[model samples]
Target: MIDSDLPLLNLRDICKSYGSTPVLNGVSLALNGGQTLALTGESGSGKSTLLHLAAGLDQPSDGSVHLDGEDIGRLDDAGRAQIRRDRIGLIFQQFNLVPSLNVAANVALQAQMANRFDAAFTAEISDRLGLSDLGARYPEQLSGGQQQRVAIARALAPRPELILADEPTGNLDEETGDIVLTLLLELVAETGAALMMVTHSPRLAQRLSREVHLSRGQLAVQ
Candidate 1:
C-alpha cells in the first residue's frame, strides 16, 4: 500500500541496457518527501536515463524502482501512466506545452488531468512565475525563460508528491536559470514535494540538499 512513511522514490541496483549496450549499472538512490537531490554528470553519463527510470517512463533491466512503496517495475503501462499523471511532476528541457493551449490552460492542464485543479492556486502560480500577463499567449509567443516558467507552473500545479526534472534550466541565461531554480526550489519546499533534478551546473547543484554524480552508469555521492 502507498504510505506517507515510505520514501517517495527508491531505486536499488538498477541497470539498463539496449542490445547489450549498457546504460545504468547498480545505481541506487532514495529520495524522501521535502528533500531535493541534484543529479549531475557529463553527456552520455546516463543522467537522463536514470531520471526516466525513476519516473517510470522506462523500466530497469535489473533491480527495482519503488515509488511511494509501490514497485513501479511490476506495473503495466496503464498503471504506470496513471501513477505518473496523478503523483509525479516532470519538467524537461523541451518544455512540452500544447501549442493550441494558452499559457493559463497549459499551466492548469496537468492539474486538471490529476483532478486537483484549483483556480486560485493556478492563478497564484502564474503570478508568481511572472506569467500573469502572459496567460493568453501561446508557447511561441513567449521567450525561452517564459516558456520554461510556464512548464514549471504546469508541473507544480498538481501539488504532486515527487518532481523529476531533466536540465530544466539548461536553455536559459544564467540569470533566468537562477530565477527558475529559485522558484522551483521554493515552490517544492512550500508543497513539501521530493525533487530529483538532473543538472550539469555545479553551481546550481550546490543549492540542493544532496548531490550525486553519475559516471559510467554508476552513481557516487558528491
Candidate 2:
C-alpha cells in the first residue's frame, strides 16, 4: 500500500549544471497522487531538464529527487532504470514507438520489461485507446495520431503511479492534437495517476490542474 501523506513525486532544491553552465537552480516541486500539473517554460528554460530529473533519467547537480518515497538521486543507474520501467510512464512528442514491433508488442514492452505483464490489462488499455483493431499493425503503418495513442498505451500498460508527458501532441494537427489530449486526459483520470506534462501552449497547459513556469532557471508564479 502507498503512504497517503507522501507526494507521488517530489523534488527539493534541484540544481543542474554542465561544467560551468547552469540549467536549473534551486528548483523545487511536488506532485501528489491523482493530481495533474503542467510544466511550462520557453525554450532552454529547464523544463525538459526538470522532467528528466523527475523521471530519473538524469541526476541533479545538487538537491534530491524522490518518487514514491525513494530518493532517486541516491539510486544507481540500474535502480533508476527500474524505477522508470516499473513506477513511471513516459510519453514523448516523437511517439517513440518501436519500429520493429507490432502494436501489441510495443504496448506490452514495458510490462514485460518489468516482469509484470498482464495480458488482460494490456488488452483493456489497447481497446480503450482504440488500438485493439490495429494490434497487428507496425509503427510505420499507423498515422501520427494512432502512433501517439500506441505510445500512450505502451506507457500505461504497466499501471505506473506517475505519468510524464513531453509535448505529447506536438506532432499532430490542432484537431488531432485536441482529440489526443482529450483521450490522454480521460485515460489518465481513469488510472488516477499523477501527471506532469511539459507544454509551451497556454491552451494546452490549462488543460491540467495548474501550471509551473520557469524563468531563467527559476520557478515563476503560476
Candidate 3:
C-alpha cells in the first residue's frame, strides 16, 4: 500500500511508444516527499523516458501521473507547463544553463520565470551548493562538477515540491560524480523535496531510500 503520510507522486500503468517502438510499457511507481527514488536500467530501458513523463516534459500514451494529489496527465499543455514552471524542478547531465548568463542569473532564471524568485532563498541555495564564490562566473568558465553544481543550484532555488534528475552525474568522473550526488541528496533532504533520479550506477542507486529497476519499460522493485 502507498503511504499517506508522505507527499504523493503516483504513476499508474504508464505507457509510452515511438511509432511501433514501445519505450515504457505499463510502468507504475510512487514517490513521496523527503524520499529519494533511484531509477536504474540498461541503455534503452526507458529510464529517461519515464523521468520525462513524470516531469510532464512529455506525455504518456496511456496512464496517469499525479503529483500532490493532482493528475498531471489530464492537464492541458498550458497547465502542464504551469506545473513544470511552478512546482517541478529538473536537472540534467548536460547542465542546460545559458552560457551568457553568470551563475547568479542562471540560477535565478527559472524562479524569475515562475514569478517566485526570492533573492534570499536563491542566495541560501547558492551557498548550500557551494556556488557562492562562482556567482559571477559563466558556465563556460566552470569545470564539469561546478557546472553541475550550478544546475543543481538553479533547480533548487525555486524550492519546488519535486525534483526530477536525469543522469545528473553521468558526465562526471567517479569521484566528482559522488561528490555531486552527495550535494544533491543533501540539498534535497534539507528542502524536504521528493527526488527521482534516473541513473545506471548501482552505487548511486543504493544511496537512495529506494531503488527501482526498469526493464523493457516495466518497473520492478529492487
* RMSD in Å for all candidates: 1.5, 2.0, 2.9
What tens digits encode model 3's per-residue C-alpha lDDT throughout 124-185?
87876678999899999999888987887788778787889998887678886787678778
Q: Rank order by lDDT, top first?
A: 1, 2, 3
Q: Which ten contiguous residues of candidate 3 have the minimum total lDDT?
A: 1-10
lDDT of 2 by residue, 83-125 (tens): 8998899987778788999999999999899887999988987
lDDT of each: 0.89, 0.87, 0.85
Q: What lDDT score is found at residue 25 in candidate 1?
A: 90
Local distance difference test, candidate 3: 0.85
On TM-score, the leading prediction is: 1
Question: Best lDDT goes to which candidate?
Answer: 1
Which TM-score value belongs to model 3?
A: 0.88
Weakest 10 consecutive residues of candidate 1 by summed lDDT: 1-10
Worst 10-residue lDDT window for candidate 2 reads 179-188
Regions of model 3 farther than 4 Å from truth: 1-7
lDDT tens digits, residues 1-222, model 1?
236788888999999998889999999988888889999988998999998999899989999999988899899999999998999999987798999999999999999999999999889878877899999999999988889889988998998889999998877788878877887788778878889999988899999999999999998665
Q: Could you estimate the TM-score for every candidate?
A: 0.94, 0.90, 0.88
| Full-model lDDT, candidate 1 | 0.89
Clashing pairs in 3: none
